[model samples]
Target chain A: MRYALRGGKRLRGFLVLESAALHGISRAAALPAAAAVEALHAYSLVHDDLPCMDDDDLRRGQPTVHVRWDEATAVLAGDALQTLAFELCCDPVLGPAERRVALVAALAKASGAEGMVLGQALDIAAESAAAPLTLEEITALQAGKTGALIGFAAEAGAILAGADRLPLRAYAEAFGLAFQIADDILDVEGDPEAAGKRLGKDAGAGKATFVSLLGLERAKARAKDLVTMAELALAPYGAAAETLRDAARFAIARQS
Target chain B: MRYALRGGKRLRGFLVLESAALHGISRAAALPAAAAVEALHAYSLVHDDLPCMDDDDLRRGQPTVHVRWDEATAVLAGDALQTLAFELCCDPVLGPAERRVALVAALAKASGAEGMVLGQALDIAAESAAAPLTLEEITALQAGKTGALIGFAAEAGAILAGADRLPLRAYAEAFGLAFQIADDILDVEGDPEAAGKRLGKDAGAGKATFVSLLGLERAKARAKDLVTMAELALAPYGAAAETLRDAARFAIARQS
Candidate 1:
């Protein structure tokens, strides 16, 4: 489980910390939520790389869980890590019971059937799709696949502080879409060495992605636009959200 | 998800509902917790049946998730069901925010590293052990893998009613152990048709089990003793606990 958690951008964790800071929630109070999101993300990656899933042998520059260990260990490790995420959310350090309950509920919603799992199911079904997915279909898929967790991470602070979550939610929505577009862009042109995993898998599969549907140049432009929207959504936070705005820009610029 | 959840004894869920009823908690109020545990159990079973895990092709006389659908679907369905369990716990109908949070925390504790997952990991490790596990080691493993969830289910009502949990906790501990012993006995002597799945698997795998260590007669005696202890723990509830006593007896006597 620890090996699986090692080496990542830690973007979702950062989102939790930064958003919590914006809401005047102490770093200590928010750290658990940050760790929780990271653990959850790690679990997803572990399972996604399974022999029966993407069947990837590499992740984050190291052998994937199933490749490093046995398949049973990989499966059990992922399961345990997921349970750990929820356990982290139950930490008393997070503050009021109501807020803690809200975090549990929100995380469950974001990561469950209506969210990440739904997106994954659609993605699997898409493999045998009669035709490539439309832009709108892909958009919806990415919303659940990537957007929900980011949304939860960004909104964690507001939930902790019992403040309005609208602004962070808007920022998360734009930022998440930009992030997915960036991933799609990476699939078109990325160094597998730096990325720490096989690149161009979408293209190899002949699957429709942002790059395939929009072309590389147009996809880059769309990503830039989404980043701008992400930044603009932070107007309510003003200077306090500068770091978050910078994160949006970094999402597009990142190579891996 | 629906297919994954079909046809099981629903013992964990039944424990929750019955325990809740003992404390005068309404069935409707407890339904989410009931459903949540059942969903969690179903998810565990689905994953356990995967090719990488127990590799079972049948469950409750029906094709296992991976056998009926595909490995990808089984994985996703199990993942989704796990998320659904936490979501169900977050149901507003569960009552005060504090209670809901408590439920989430308890369930997480029961199902995570120190609980069910730990037991599973140990079980897997035991398969490759230099020698068969001792009675003590097997006992510890079963407590985590199977007993923890039962403990949680039995105590959930007390948690909901905010009553003294010590008695129910005692009842649960004894009942859970007895339940496991009965299962070991079934492995030694059970009809595949009645049990709804393969029997003699433990002996077939040369895995250490209660019956193997204690012999059939002594294992049966131990289970009877535990059931007695389970019933004695419910003395405080008196006549209101008769149903629970019956459940304890049924655990040892049931053919399935």
Candidate 2:
């Protein structure tokens, strides 16, 4: 399990902490929620990299869990990590039981059938599909596969504070789309050593992506527009949300 | 997901309901918890039947998830099912947020590395060990793999009612061990048609089990003694727990 969680950009964890701070929630109180998102994200990556799934041998520039240990270990480790996510959310330091239960519910919805898992199933189905997905379809697919968890992370602080989550939700939606678009851009041009994994698998598999459907320049332009929208969504918090706005910009600018 | 859940005896669900009734928690309010345990059990079976895991082609008399669909679908379905378990535990009908969070925490601990997953990991490790597990080791392995969740199910009512759980926990531990011993007995002598899956796989793989270590007659006797202990554990609940007592008897008597 430690091997699977070794390294990452920790973007989702950052969202949880940043959003919590925006709501005036202490970093100490929000730490478990931050760790929960990272653990859950790690679980998804472990499973996605399984031999029966993407069959990748590299992740974060290290041997994948299945390659390092074995398939059974990878599966079990992923399963336990997923369970750990829920367990961490129930920690007492997260504040009231109501808040913790709320977090658990939101996390489950975002990561389960109606969210990430649905996105995965659709992606798998699309592989044997008669034609590549359209730009609109790809957006919808990414919304579930990646957008849901990101949205949950951003909204987590609001949930913890019992505040309205609409602002954070809007920010996450735009930011998540921008992030995916940037990922496509990175795949097309980023150095493999910097990205820490194979960069051209989407094209190699003939899969549709934002860049594939929108063209390189158009994709980059779309990402920029989305980042602006993400930044604007944080206007309700004024300068207090500057870090979040910077995060939106960073999403599109990061190499990995 | 529904395919994976079909046709089980639902002993875990029954335990949840029965235990809840013992604590005066109405079945209506306890239904989601009942469903949660069943979903979790189904998820475990689906993943356990994966090609890299147990590699079983059949479960509950039907083609296993991996066989019915494909490995990728099976993996995603199992992942979603596990997520569903957490979601179900958060159902508002289950009661206050405190109770729900408590349930989620207990469920996560029971199913994760400290419990069921640990047992599974130990089982896999034992497969390639220098020698077959000793009787004591096998007992310890089954305690986690099977006993943990069963204990959770049995204690869920007490949790819901904010009642003491020690009695139910004791009952469940004995019942779970007895159940596994009965399973080993069945594998040795039960009909494949009745058992709904391949029989004798443990012995075929040279794995140590209650029947192997204790001999058929002795194992049967041990299970009977366990049923008595399970029954005795329910003494505090008086006639209200008679059905649970019956369940203990049924655990050993059932063919499947």
Candidate 3:
């Protein structure tokens, strides 16, 4: 957890909080859900840092959980974090069954195998990936692996905010794509210093990329389009959803 | 999944089906929920078999997931089954939001850390268990680890049947304790051949046991009392819960 916080993306937290506020849910009401989401994000990184997984030695310029502790300890700590996220869902501030269950359901999608694990699975599966992946297959794989969790985080705010399913599901899809495109672009163009680690390894590995598949110009357009779609989903909530809107644009546009 | 299906006492599934049937729910309407409960049961087994976790090699005369397919796949498969339980809850086949969400909540409790994973943590923690676990502490561990899921299954049935919470919870709890006690007895005195595996390891490990803490006869009596109590919880349901009553008696008396 210490290592996880070193390179904290306060932006993600801000997006979650802002959307909840827009929805008129109080700080106390949203804190648990927000904490759970962030914890989940951290836990993903912790596991992603593992030798068999992403194999990063450092995160946020600090030794990762696996490096600081050991592989076994890192594994257990990640397991503990997953458990803690669920426990926090009992955050008494959000007592309504409708909202709580909604948050829980979204979290499951963002963090579980179908979303994050499946994504990681694909990343590893592609280590020796021979065939060129089609646009559809790449989209599906990225959606399940990287995009799904971000989609969860974005849509989670709307759910907590009491937004209906149409907007919630819509923003979820858009933000998910936006998040993936941003990460992909970063890999292609980002300075290793700015990204806090390696860059272009994906291309070196011959792994598929938005740039590789769609070209840089087209990928940039796709990211912009997704950001616009994400913002429009929040239009239903008027200004309350603006923070989420801004975050989507910043997420895709920010160089780092 | 094949190995996960082999060794369960099925006490949890029994309580769920029994309680629901008593409340006038048809078997057809109850199928999905029952399968879900079973899947949860299967999932817990799969996780419990991991190397960094229980390090167990044998289950129901078969190698565990970690032993059979490697740790990563076991982890992923467990993750998939858990989300599958939630998706099952959303099945169009399941009726009445009250029952569906309630069932989902119960299912989550069984698999999540505080319940099963926490129990496993405590059990594994015992390898270097910092403190001497009292009989009560050990019981709590088993209750949370093993009993809670079983209880969830029973409660799932009652929720589907639309039974009141008081009866639902009561029936589930009694069955949980009864189910664990039966395992304790089986471990101590039952036949390995009938039980489908070895039975003497817990004693060698010096793991907590009812026979060690409460004596064999006292534990046997306690198991019987728990069965009686489980049946009493369903007095309101009468004949509808009769199968549950039979299962409880079977649990304590089973040779395996």
Top candidate when judged by TM-score against the true structure = 2
As a whole number from 0 to 100, the lDDT of residue B138 in candidate 3 is 80
Show the lowest summed lDDT stretch of 10 residues, model 1 chain A.
A115-124
Estimate, for each residue in B1-256, the C-alpha lDDT of model 2 and write its tens digit.
9899899899999999999999888999999999999999999999888988889998999999999989999989989999999999999999999999999999999999999999999998998899889999999999999999999999999988888999999999999999999999999999998989989999999888999999999999999999999999999999999999999999999999
- Give the Cα error of residue B24 in candidate 1, in Å: 2.0
Estimated TM-score for each candidate: 0.98, 0.99, 0.79
Q: Evaluate fnat for each of the predicted models and list the values in order.
A: 0.83, 0.88, 0.14
Best by lDDT: 2
Q: In model 1, which residue pairs have backbone atoms overlapping below 3 Å?
A: none
Error of 1 at B122 (Å): 1.1
Q: Please, what is the whole-model Cα lDDT of each candidate in the order they appear?
A: 0.92, 0.94, 0.70
Best by DockQ: 2
* Candidate number that wins on DockQ, 1 or 3: 1
Clash pairs detected, candidate 3: A119-A145, B22-B240
Interface RMSD per candidate (angstroms): 0.8, 0.5, 3.4
Candidate 3's interface RMSD, please?
3.4
Tens-digit lDDT track of model 3 for A56-88: 886665678878876655665565566456545
User: For all the predictions, what are the DockQ values?
Assistant: 0.85, 0.92, 0.21
Candidate 3 DockQ score? 0.21
Compared with the real two-chain complex, what DockQ does model 2 have? 0.92
Off by over 4 Å in 2: none
